[model samples]
Target: MKFGPIPTLQAKGSILAHSIVCSGRRLRKGVMLEDAHIEQLSASGITEVTVAQLQENDVHEDQAAAELAKALVPDVRAAGLECTAAFTGRVNLVATGPGIVDLQADRLIALNSIDPMISFATVPNYQQMRKGGLVGTVKIISYAVDAEKLRSACALGSAAIKILPPQLKTASLVVSQNANRNDEKGISAIKTRLDALGITLEKVIATEHEIDPMAKALSSLKSELLLILTSSATSDSNDTAPAAVRAAGGQVERFGIPVDPGNLLFLGRIQSRPVIGFPGCVRSPALNGADWVLSQIACGVSLNENSFAQMAIGGLLKEIPTRPQPRRPKK
Candidate 1:
């Protein structure tokens, strides 16, 4: 695109590169200078104005942004995302419902590498997303961009962003507590977490903080997802929660994720039902490793061995104020 100062008489049909006040009216930038606009500016004693004129081979910013958005989300319904109408040089993608943000990172990187004038930004890969949440955005920096580069970006980023909506609609939580302990915080916290993913907590059964009782409770669960929150923190793969899953005829896949504040979580499955051992950090609303696992499972997005390896990469979460100890010892 050609952008520079030009005589008011020669500015007609070009995009205004900057906002200016003319004839006591505020003319916004990106507006196409017309004959009346030029005449008004000339009458107001303005001799020059900067504007951007599109070249034959250039694509208009709004058009380019709209096209890129379409390419990124081919089927809005299936992708579980909706594209807002392109405005100026921006188009936003939002979730149609609660789910997980499944972004294609490699494709996004390639798209951004094509040129500096176009950018696609998103919430990270596998992010927990809620209904009407902002998933991603496409922005064209300049008033116009090279058509060839825009096409390349569109092709490389095709179908690159989507939301995996929740698959499991209901869950049953089994809490283990002593006879005198009637703490409802764990149950409330678990319900809040499940509600965020649009899942219903069908039952909250409290049992003795014992392997046999908890195992029996877990084995009798009929919800799509099963959960166990022990009064004591799970310290190892062979701890109470994981051992209870095994005792319930379930297969324990993993124990003790690497995320701080959530390092004690365990994952397993009973035939078809998935079980999650909530860590002590779940009493707070802050993001933790358990939220990641729950969101992935709720969306039916399975990973090999229900992997905790990926969690370690960005698992150092903000410490909850309720934590009794710090990550490091005092000097």
Candidate 2:
């Protein structure tokens, strides 16, 4: 692209490089200087203005950004997302329905690295968003980019972000028999959190705190998802909850995550069904590691050891001030 001063009379069909105020009206940058605009600038006594003229191989900014954004998003709409028309070298990914934004951070990083002129940004991975939320955006840095660079960036960014509809629709809660009064509060809190995600707590199984009974309960339970709310947090893969999962012929994917307030969370699967061993922090509805794990499960995102490990980058859930405050002593 060639950018330099061009006489207003000769600037027709070129993109304005900067906004100019003329006769009480503003001519914004990126506006293609039409004959009318050229006449208006001449009438306003503007002799010359800086503009960008595209070379034969250069792609227009808006078209390039729109194509890259299209390549980045998956072909499947997934239920809650809409892609806006590219404008000003930007295409915004908006949420059409309320749900979690599931972004592939690693792929996004790769996409951005492919070209300096192309970039993308999104709400944090696994963020709960309302309808019409800005989930992701694609931006091209210059008035125009080389066609080859745009194509390379698009190849790198294909299917890098997804808006997943909440999928943890039905669940069963298994609590220990020695569950205290706090258990009621915890159950209520879990219900409220799940309800927000459109998950229903269809059945409750209260059993002895022993591993054998827990295992039996898990083996016998029939639900799309199983949640174990233990009186105590599991300390290891061999802990009671995880042990029960193993005894019930389930595979324990991971024992703990790097996220605080959710460090004790356990993830396991039994015959294709997900089982989450909740940490004590789950008793309260504050955002925590458990919420993160649950949100991923609900969104149908695959979970494994590496998935929990990758969360360390943004795992500081307790640092948010709006997080539920610890109970204070009665005056």
Candidate 2 root-mean-square deviation in Å: 4.0
The TM-score of candidate 2 is 0.81
lDDT values for all models: 0.89, 0.84
The residue ranges of model 2 lying beyond 4 angstroms of the native Cα positions read: 74-80, 95-107, 124-131, 164-168, 177-180, 206-220, 236-240, 243-253, 320-331
Tens-place lDDT digits, model 1, residues 1-331: 9999999899988999999997998889999988889888898899999999999999999999999999999999999999999999999999989999988898899899988899999997889988889989999999999999999999998998899989999999998997766659878888999999999999988888888888999888899999888888888888878888999999888777788878888889998999998888888888988899899999998866435677778889888877767787569
| lDDT, model 2, position 39 | 84
lDDT of 2 by residue, 269-314 (tens): 9999999999888876678888888877887889766777788988
TM-score of 1: 0.97
Instruction: Show pairs that collide, candidate 1.
Output: none
